[model samples]
Target: MRFAPLSLLISLSLLSFSAVSQDTNTVTAIENDITLKQADFDSFTEILNKHLKDESQQQHQLDLLRARSTKLEKEKNQALDAMNALYRRLIEDPSLDISDTKLRYQNAVDSHKTNKEDIAMQLASISAHRKDIEKIRIDRHALLNTLEGLKEQKNTARVERLRNEFNRDGTLEIQNTINCKRTETLAACEQRGQHLGMQKATKRFLDQVFANLTEIRLVEPKRNSAGARVQVLNSHVVNSGFSGHGNYDVNLSVTMRGDANNSRLCHLLNLDNRFCSEYSSSFQSIYSPQQSSNFTGNVRFSDPVTVSTTYPEIEKKSQTYNKPVVNILNEPEIDYTHELTLRSNVHDDEVFIDGVSYGSTRLSVQLPVGIHDIEIRKLGYNTFKKIINLSKAQTLKARLVKNKSHLVSKPIVETQISNISVPGMVVIPAGSFEMGDITGNGLANEQPVTKKILSDSFDMNAKEVSVSQYNSFAVETNYVTEAESGKGCAYYLNGEPVWEPSLNWKNPGYEQEDDFPVVCLTYNDAKAYADWLSSTTNNEFRLPNEVEWEYAARAGTTTDYSWSNDIGSNQANCGWCGSEWSNKSSSPVGSFSANQFGLYDMVGNVWEWTQKTAGQSDVAVRGGAWNFAPSLARASTRLILSTDFRANYIGFRLVKER
Candidate 1:
């Protein structure tokens, strides 16, 4: 009997052992792949089920909105029919007065119009819910398709694996039969046939493994002949099997091609050498033919991933329906209040509405829709009283006649009038008042109320120093303000004072009209302006002392502010004081109601520099500016600023001594 060569048998035996090992590994890999694909399929199924549930909910919501819309439309039609019937009754009934019938018809018409709007809004909501339901259904369908595709892919992989196993087994059986016919014993024939089958299977596995290899590269550092480092670069290895499931240990033999002198070019060219000579140089480098690298790692395979699933959201709308016409007309209660704007000839006369003082005229108050007694009175004017049945908003102008008896008994002061001799100055009457925080809601500096008595009257500016007035002084004296000469004026930014090099009195970081108060002044600057004014007018013009400032600011009233203690709206131009220019910029002089002494902006608009000194280098400023809080605008609130400091919120008003 003829037998195979010893070397050939040994090679076949080794191939058989390798084939068995590879088969076991491949089976495990296929099982893992199938498991991952099944998990993906299950995940997609869960998403599809969830979307189906959302679709049901959305459909139910759509149905409810449609039903509500239909009900609203029916109610709208009924309301329209009722309105038409009411109109026809008004036209047919001759005994019905136009007034009573017209009111009822108007109510009915409003009810019908409101119902129509509600129906339209309901229909719009229904349409939106329907669109939401449609989108949910579409998403559900996509998820279902994805699940089916995953299932099909998983089944196909299983089929391919089973077919490969069957082919390998059948080839082994056929080889066994052929070898039995050629050999003497059945046992030897079976062994020989098994070896042949294994050889074929190994060949198939190696062919597949090599076919999947996309690239083979050698990556190492390049060194000079003297073993000194020269340059280094990177190389990459790519394999189609990277996307398959298995762990592999690949051994690579790299050989350098070309003459030893020019062997460095092999790394750049990526040339493959099969019969290169062994490198025997003292330097053992990457260029040696026998050098090999072993790369061992596990390649993880990923199945087709399920897409992110999101369900459409249904919009919820609020339901609003108009009250019935009968209910609206038969309602017994009414608003009963009407706005009454009261005016008087005297600018600062006290006004009383229903015996409740509503500050001074011109003012507005809401009076009940009934008879209200209105009273307007001043110190020397006859009390004007009126009784009016107010059912609607109206403006009442009262001209008070002078009470000769009161005026003669209590002689009026001459300080009530502005001093014509001193232009733009008002005579402030000498009076005794409790200065400081009489309201007890002020700062520490405003505490310890003290009674101050001014024995003499003084002529003070009726308004804050205007931009026009300061400009006149600047032009006449040809003087540059400290802010313009040195550092620019400080302005409020982000709730803190920031010194801007570009800002000055003329440009206080915001636009200012000529009539607005002039700000960004230091104590010395204000003193200089006062000196200039004193020289020009031949009067002693100077900053008011703190006591004089508080006296004039309080006027005759001992309240927190000149007008009242409440810091009422539209009374001043300070921050949060309820003026259009509050906290933004200084308003024009006399923009708000004046104090009782006919003084404008005594408590707000700008912090005025006073002649009083607080510390060695600090000067007292009275009132508050447009950017300060309302509390800071109190009559007694005092701010001590450095004498050389200049800011947008600091300005000055002159007091001319009489």
Candidate 2:
């Protein structure tokens, strides 16, 4: 925000260049002063470098010497050790190598008379060499004086020049400052003169330019004296330039003034610095204390930052203390609310608001005002975000729709009928396959992939029997489902519903829905319905084996889900899975696109009961239903529910062998 003033900035920049020149000149003067000493210094440095290199070489040589010495010591010790074995020979004539120099000396004494005469001659030769070395020392001492004298003269001149340069630089700075002031003052005077002349000469020119403004008028306030309104007639907004230090000055005059209470004129100001105070004030309060602490705090920052979360602000607070302070203190306390909702498809989706999860069609949560994110998760569905901006009262509605994720889905290999016009039944083929996830896809026991071979083809009701289908079935059997049974509301009759389960299949709970799948059927009731169909049609009508159910559900691929493995609105329906799950739950059998074998709700939707239970005890159910994650909807996925336990989402489809 603090931009340098243009002219002053240029002046300071120019001063820096001059200062650099002065610095260079100072260095040159210093160089001249030391010129005489250069040779001596150079020679000293050269010798020092050579000495250092020699020292390194000497160190290596010393290491070699030490190694050789150790070897010699070892050899000497070996000789000493061997001496005991050769003790007799050593005593007789000394086996170690020693020359008989004493015998030679005695021979010399006897052959030539004076041994002392030879020592005198050697001492005289040593005396002559000492005299020559003394003269050489004298010559070196003289050379030292010449070098010292030259250095002294050069240093004196350099010191004088440095004093003069310092004075000159200060003088130049003062002169420049005076000149700049004069120049500014003269320019201002010239500008004033020109402005006066121009005003007189361009009066008519200005009038012509201002002619359009004649129609504009200033309105006075009725009674209040605060302000007046300047209504320009037919004025068009042109280019709006920047304000403050960035823009040029413009001149305008107000024609009238208005009262305080009823001002006809309104002023709109673009304030740029209002928020700056808040930022700087907070920063000063926080950082000022930190700077005075014993441990030097290193958090330096400018004002007007964009961090909106309290976590980072807390971290900034914690930084004020040293490392030891963190160990002794408690963390700051905060309170805020979090809300989640379902988006896109409402009917099959439910939202988890606050902490309580809803499998219902819709949900909402009331949260405390603060920064919080919502997770819209649907079982067998993919989760998406609903940015929670609950500053005021906010309502978030997310519809759970499905999205496809893969190139292919498991194949449902069942038969097809050419006419395919059976009132409301969808025909499915029969085949053999491993029922459960044999490859360990993490599905339950009903998925125990046993090899089951269905020898005949079969017809399955396309969807779980709907209300209309169940009503027809009920009318034919003259039996009512427990949900539809009169006042008593039919409780468990011998572990099975009193009414035919498929009587009003479309409205499982007797809720009056004709398209929804029927629920509340026992194993016996389901079998009874299949038995009746087989007798009437003269075809093999029995519950589909677990294998046939998965094969029909998966179609063919072994992916965890059908409809490309993405759960949600695109595939099947089930509970309020705010997100997509691999095995997310059920839909009405045909809610999603049909698999290759033309079976719907194979991946998601209700878990269809199968004839194959683990040991004739646990009921086998295939294909994950709604309110579940996508992981449970795989072809091999399985779950078991008690036959008597019935819920809105739990429904069944019938299969028969042709």
Candidate 3:
């Protein structure tokens, strides 16, 4: 049924009959045959490869869709939070005499509602892609089923062909060709003319070859190239009276094939693959049954004939499983009431937790029993940040070392900050206060409470650089920010910040006056603008260093804020400050009163970029933005950002150091 054992096929192929001087043609039609070609296998393999490629592409699409769904889920939660905050305010909001507070609240509410709808649409798109993934899986299963059917068809055809080749009509024709005379003289043939040894040998050969197909066809030596061999079906005709016993004769013919590379092994050890080789030989031998009266016949086949063939195991791909998505919207709060001792190799290096300043290293502090972000930093040395999992009180020690860090060049522009051409700037006298040091807020990195001095005086912008000025610069230089060149700057589209095209400072997803601070400017963009201003104005204007900015922002006062410990309404633009512009993007320059240094709009409008680089790709941003909480607006609060970071709440102002 499976391709017949090589020996049986060869034996059947050798059937022949000879009646007289000339042999009879036995295989008139039975010999003509169809065979499997190597090309057939090649074609099937190609089909398999094509299906595999399609399957791989579908899987890639599924992975991308899954990621999109996860992002949308996060946006949905953020939008809900924004809407809730507005609702709470609307209930207790005072009927103030300043502006239309109700209308402002309604507009913000509608914006969040729109954002939620957009996220829902994205989720729906993911669902469609998921359905496509299922369809691909089903199609792949069908391909496998087709492959199984093809194998079944090939095997069935092979069995039917073998049966047709070895039936009674085919055997009768062989007898005539081989001159095997079928007679009824039983006693004469068995007692006097039986060729027992010959009979036993032939039978044993057929039995052994048929029983071990795997060994002979796969493990043993073989050949696939075309060749032929002949095997005789019977002995020549002989009568018992010719001698003391009847003589039996058998004939044989053999042929072998060479390998594709002409290997001699294949030449000598050719296999009978139906299409690769064809030969037949009649059984020929001589023996007398009378001489075997006391013979107990025994026939044994030696080891299998070693064949040479190259076959590689076939491999199939298995299905892959993808884990379900999980959105972690909230984490359980930890009660960190106990204090622990922490020490560092250097005394002046700062420490931090969750990017907030608590105290410097080598101090006792209370932390949650879970994971906390611990960092130690110094200006010249590389900052070390780690996630520490604490369960109990323990003393932690750290070693800080300096890396090769390059300081920013001083501003080259020398024009008055209050020049009338652009938005005005403010002048602050040279002074110092523990580096504008403040306690009670920030990570260890933000906790440099030591009284460091600012020796040189500098002039800073009275307000942040505004949109109109930045746009003029962009048009003049024909320069594009990283976001514009790639995806756009991050804007609050549907409740959370997402990168959108044409969403740079020119269009920060909101209506704005020209005097409002430009938002979504990357650190490099701010630096580029400062250099341009220096070249254009013939003055040394550049962004302020972290220390210089802090000194001026503090305005010579050493308190939690530039004004008071508790910031009230109309003080600054912040999330909880209750200002008219709270959580509503940047306010116009000079919107807020000036600090002691006569500098206005310093606390909040947009987060200002500083000329300070952090341990990672981030630079320092100070003075918090309109959307951020009041704590971020504190004089000492600092946040790190990637050099190319661009968000709607971020911007920069310039300073002239002398």
Candidate 4:
């Protein structure tokens, strides 16, 4: 038999050579076989070397492909991570719209997954290529051995048959090569497509997230039923009977006035159907309630005043015709009983005295022989008692000075009243109290005492800002107080008081007096005064809020009067209030007396202004005035007025905060 190529024969022998032996006659055959095997071995070695080189190149290509796939996978994972981070950030930012970002990010994530899947799928393709290449290498090795072995065998027929078979196998190998090449090319294309998609998705996600950074909104003001913004300026003081008048302007901060569908004023003024500015004239000033003072005096008859009887000699007779009789009866001849002097203890400066029904520095009365008991009382001052035994003709002298210390001024102490030349200023402390009122109490508004806490301490005037005080402020600041203007106020001239139309702070009837409270002022004017005081004295001065006013007035006592509930005696200086006002006009601050808070003229004088304004209405006023009742003077009472109108009963005070 023709032996296979020596290389193949040796390779097969290695497998079973241990079972066979080498010897002599075999030596001759072995020598020839050795020579032929040597030739075949050389040829086999040459072909196998070429095949190995080709297989090595194919393996190197596969290795390069695997490395590229690995790199793509790493890139895909990184891109996916970036996309996820962007999505997370977009979701967390409150201002950002993450829908577009999410869409792009999801696409990016999907693309990365697709890339990985593609790579994985390509792995199978690569594996197939590897297997095909390996198969090709095996086939080439076998064919080469067959070709080499046949030449050595020197059998022409076997050579031709092996060559034909080898050629047919080689042709089949070409098909395998073509398959591997096609698979590798398709895998590469798929990989490139996935990578491109991933990159685009990543870029899109980033761009979307970056664009989601800017978003904001502004809200507009809503309109009321009146289509106008009715603002309450603040509480103001007005006389007891006068109607309060004030102006309110709408705020056009959020919407333009021209753009509004309709504009009107609402509240006590009730101008909702009309333009707000039109009513400005009506509210130019408010008139406070009118108050009337009652008068009482000691009836006295003395020789100094009786001289008029001696001069009365002229008599009138009847003019008649025939029988006219003249019967002129002379005054009855009687003894002129001496006029006795009566007296009371009370100061007549400008204070409202209680129980006397008259205001006088000294009260005097003539009485028959009897024992008389006399008592002295002032609005805010304590009473003085006196029991005297009197003869038929006796003269007595007595003094009535204010008695303090009987009232508790805890929330507002009397010591805080600075003698500073500033007009009508008082100080208030920081505290909590109920404001407003309910029905059970006398005043309609004093019943519901809403609890309020004040964070800062402040000061207020002991009484309303008197005309005298306002004049001083105007002089110093070159500014006008509302009362000073002749717009709508009563002015005290030389020794008489009159309502003037053109009299103002700039042209006052009598501006030199500094004891009266500033009056006829608007809310803006009060604010200006507060500002000026702060700037000039380095102190914070302002208006008293409703809560502070009640707290200060009550002064720890929840009673009608600071001294007592009975309004007959220990009340305040007011006209027709409790019995009478001694027939007088506005009394000075602290003239009637101070409340438990050491606040003077809190009631029965002029209504004091507060910082609070009526909601949806004109400005409000507090404390009762001279013409008001004792019930109205309760700390919880509330009165309202227009901003532009002024009256004789209205007044205000100043405040400072520490």
Top candidate by TM-score = 1
Error of 2 at 380 (Å): 24
Reference-based lDDT, each prediction: 0.55, 0.39, 0.50, 0.42
Per-model TM-score on C-alpha atoms: 0.43, 0.33, 0.36, 0.36
| Model 2 agreement with the true structure over 1-658: per-residue lDDT tens digits | 1211211100112343364455556546656645644565455445544644554565555555556556555655555445444555557776554334434444444433332333344344433433333222222212232333333333333332322221121100000011112334333322222222212212222222122121123211211111111111111111111233332111211011101111011111111111111111111111111112122222211222111122111122112211221122222322223353334564454443322233454565544443344445543355545545555555566644454533123333433233221224455545565656655745234444577666655666555655455455566788654444432222222212233434334344334345555555555556666666566556666677766677667654555554333343333453332324222322334554455555566655566778856544336566655544445556776554444434444557777554
- Lowest lDDT block of 10, candidate 3: 168-177
In model 2, the runs with Cα more than 4 Å from the true position are: 1-434, 438-441, 444-456, 482-512, 564-570, 576-589, 612-615, 641-645
TM-score of candidate 1 against the unseen true structure: 0.43
CA shift of 548, model 3, Å: 0.5
Error of 4 at 612 (Å): 3.5
True lDDT of residue 93, candidate 4: 78
Identify the superior model by TM-score, candidate 1 or candidate 3. Answer: 1
Candidate 2's C-alpha lDDT? Answer: 0.39
Q: Give lDDT: candidate 4, residue 139.
A: 42
Q: Which stretches of candidate 1 lie over 4 Å from their true place?
A: 1-423
Steric overlap count per candidate: 0, 84, 60, 67
lDDT of 3 by residue, 1-658 (tens): 0111122223322331121101112221212211232344345445645644655565556566566556555655665566666667667875423234444545555655665665566566655554444334334322332332333333333332222221211111111011122462433233212233223333333333323222235313332221111122232211122213333222212111101111111222231122111222111111111113233333211122111111121112221112110111122222323466778888766665543444577788764344555766654455677777666787778777765422211222323433324445656665557763366655445765778676666678777888877887788789787667767787543224567878877788777888888887788899998887887777888888888888888766676566555443466786545567877777887786566565666687788899964433346888877766665677887765556668888888888755
